[model samples]
Target: MTERILDHPVLGALEPDQTVTFTFNGMTYEGRDGEPIAAALLAAGVRTLRHHEESGTPRGIYCNIGHCFECRVEVDGQQGVRACLTPVREGMVINGGGPLPAPVRDWRKNHA
Candidate 1:
């Protein structure tokens, strides 16, 4: 069976040779700039983004809009960052396979 080359529906024919290399768990991956980290990883045939904390169940990208915690990955030196929401940068160091922290928002209050 021939391998299927998946391309973006609207972004038909990506730019030529303008690529950047990044490491995911010590493995090098190449992708174009301005694209989502998850998208690049998916195109490179990396289905497993992380695993469940206790059960160790395999995890991958879900809710491409960044609502779900399934696509969290370590970018550069930071951890628990959403890959779908983060844009790809050159020489980025992405480390996967970890539990995502609960979403939180802090509303500062000022007393005058």
Candidate 2:
């Protein structure tokens, strides 16, 4: 993939690892198996992992590590999963865009 790093300075020459097919938002994509879900998603040109629950702002991989919760996604019907810490697996179903919170909409509507 064009998004993937073919070579790294410290990591040496990058070689193709086992590829796994996973679905994101109902679209199928291929990624290196066992890599962080965040990396796989990015390599597959997926930037916005999910939207903020309250604000509805687009969220993505900010830290690339597990510290930041920006990369939250739904994995296998589970919500609030951190993609950066989770490994890519075969046939995994990931939902990057979930239903927006109704409270925000209701609050805005009522206030307006």
With candidate 1 superimposed using the best TM-score fit, by how many Å does residue 84's alpha carbon deviate from the native?
Answer: 0.6
lDDT of each: 0.77, 0.87
Worst 10 residues of 1 by lDDT: 103-112
User: For residues 1-112, could you state the per-residue lDDT of candidate 2 as single tens digits?
Assistant: 5498888889988887889999998899998999999999899898999886656778899988788888988899998889999999999999976546798678876997
Best by TM-score: 2
**CA RMSD of all predictions:** 8.0, 2.8
Clashing residue pairs in candidate 1 (N, C-alpha, C atoms within 3 angstroms): none
Residue 37, model 2: Cα distance from true site in angstroms: 0.6
How much is the lDDT of residue 76 in candidate 2?
98
lDDT of 1 by residue, 1-112 (tens): 1122545588675446567889998999888786888988988888898887545578889898988888888788887899998888899999986533433111111221
